[model samples]
Target: MTKQQIWEWFANHSKQILDFLLFLALVSMGAFVKILKQVRQGAKASWKWFLAEAIVSFFVALLVYGFFDQFMQTSTLFTYVVCAWCGSFSTIFHKRMEDLLGAIFDKLKQLISEKKSL
Candidate 1:
């Protein structure tokens, strides 16, 4: 294609690219909100746990990106895998937090009942 034709095509598609980026940003924000809700529901709000998750996620992301850069070198496939892994990991982590919260609640209730009967 001619230079003029390439320039015209880019001009026409720039808005679409911007819109897609905005959509991705919104999706990320939504996911973060969901994760926060799960963290809040846990038995205790521990900074240690938050820090650990952050560290793990950072290392995981770096490892994946490095591996892809070294071998696959396919941006599209790397993005897809990262998104899928992040989504699945978030879901599992949230469920585990909920379970821990439930267990804590049960124990607290039992303790209260025992105290009331004493």
Candidate 2:
């Protein structure tokens, strides 16, 4: 399609597009947490974990979006911030937080190793 046609189509469907993107972002966040958990535990990432992550992400997205829609009624920046916070908060529990933080530090260590090797 032409650029103009694509632009018009996107404008018409912007809300739907934005919602889908937000859903995908939430799913990614869930998957990231699962991956971090696996990494901390020395387990491999697999499709089973991914599917579980997706399911949790779907409900989290619904709760976040529904809450904002019901109460705050859609300011763009607020929606974005709250959705991001929801993704982060949903992933982190008390015990998992320490593991996740340590995993992050390990990644940083790896980065430092690479820099030293270079």
Candidate 3:
């Protein structure tokens, strides 16, 4: 394709293109976290861990992206922030998300529950 054709095609699908880039970036960052941890532990860098983290990051990004698109309003910045946070730091993010969700559920359950006797 010509330069103009490529540019037009990119413009038409910019959202998909950017989202994929975000996913790859998150995967790289996530995998790199293993190196940092290993360094802290006085160990050599492990390709096995890197590959595992990258796979986890990809799946996390995919899940967040799919859910955000399906359930939330389409805001590119919000989507990017959420995907980056959760994908790059799955363990921490998962714990935090669990707490946040628990708080929300607790509030909802409290609000919907009937009053108890004294």
Candidate 4:
């Protein structure tokens, strides 16, 4: 298709396109929050780390979307790419958190058993 054809198509679907982008952004932000919680754990929660991660994720996402908007004309495909990246990162973050929790639980159980033996 010609350049005019593409521009016209984008114009017609601009609202839907923007809505999807906003949705992806919201989901990514929510995932970041969950990851932050996981990283906190029991007494190791650090506000500095949390804020740093938040800032980094924000800039990274913005840079990615901006690059795509400037260099790529396929908005739908770009949306899917963002969604996939965020979803995968969130899943991995959750798994790591689960592992951390399990380790903490195991340590607690060991402590309890040792106390009982005393």
Candidate 5:
């Protein structure tokens, strides 16, 4: 692609790119917390565990971004701040959030089935 074409493409997709970066930042923050906890407990921290938590945080951040994006446009700075706040809890809460979402999905599925039977 030409320079102008590339610039235009980046301009158009900047918001998406920023959001993706914010998601990664959020995951990083969560991973940092997990590592700290390991240090506090005097346990040897593994890069593998940090990677796993980061992966989980990525999905959690995806859900958070979707929910927020539906309401308004998010500025990069604001996104960063929000991600930092959310990330603080992500390591401990992401799994619980996933379970809760699963329960909600199950309820919705059951409701749809009942409606179809009716």
Candidate 6:
């Protein structure tokens, strides 16, 4: 691509890029709470656990945020902030998301069965 084309593309995507960066910054704020606790407790811990938690939380929060945004449209930055505020509770959010999906599937199944009956 030409310089102008690249610049145009970057300009077009700058908003999304900014939101993505914001997402990373927000999700990241809680990724190291355990490490901080470890330091406070004066327990030497391997960095691998931190890395694992960061990666896991990142993906979990991403999924939770995606599902939330899919169900309800809202400001991306605000959503990220709220998700981050939930902190280590992403597993809870994950479970809620599962329940939502399951409910939707069950509703569809009921509708299909009704149609078959008709």
lDDT of 2 by residue, 40-105 (tens): 877766788666655665566567777887887987556655665565455554358689899999
Off by over 4 Å in 4: 1-24, 30-43, 80-118
Ranking by lDDT: 6, 3, 5, 2, 4, 1
lDDT of 6 by residue, 50-99 (tens): 77656767877776688667877777867797667565555466579899
Better of 2 and 3 by lDDT: 3
- What does the lDDT read for residue 58 in candidate 6? 83
TM-score of model number 1: 0.37
On TM-score, the candidate that comes out on top is 6
Candidate 5 lDDT trough over 10 residues, lowest sum: 80-89
Show model 2 residue runs off by greater than 4 Å: 1-9, 41-44, 91-118
Q: Residue-wise lDDT of candidate 4 within 7-92, one digit each (tens)?
A: 99999999888877775666466546656656665435577856655555554455555666666745755555674455436545
Top-lDDT candidate index:
6
Deviation in angstroms for 33 in model 5? 3.0
lDDT of 2 at 54: 54
- Give TM-scores for every candidate, taking all chains together and pairing residue i with residue i: 0.37, 0.50, 0.54, 0.40, 0.54, 0.64
**Candidate lDDT values, in order:** 0.60, 0.70, 0.71, 0.64, 0.70, 0.75
**Model 1 stretches astray by more than 4 angstroms:** 1-37, 40-43, 76-118
Residues 1-118, model 5: lDDT tens digits: 9999999999999988886776676657765775686678786667887666666666666566665655666765665556555655575675786899999999999999999999
TM-score of candidate 3 relative to the true fold: 0.54
Where in model 6 is the C-alpha error above 4 Å? 38-44, 90-118
Residue 8 C-alpha lDDT in model 5: 100
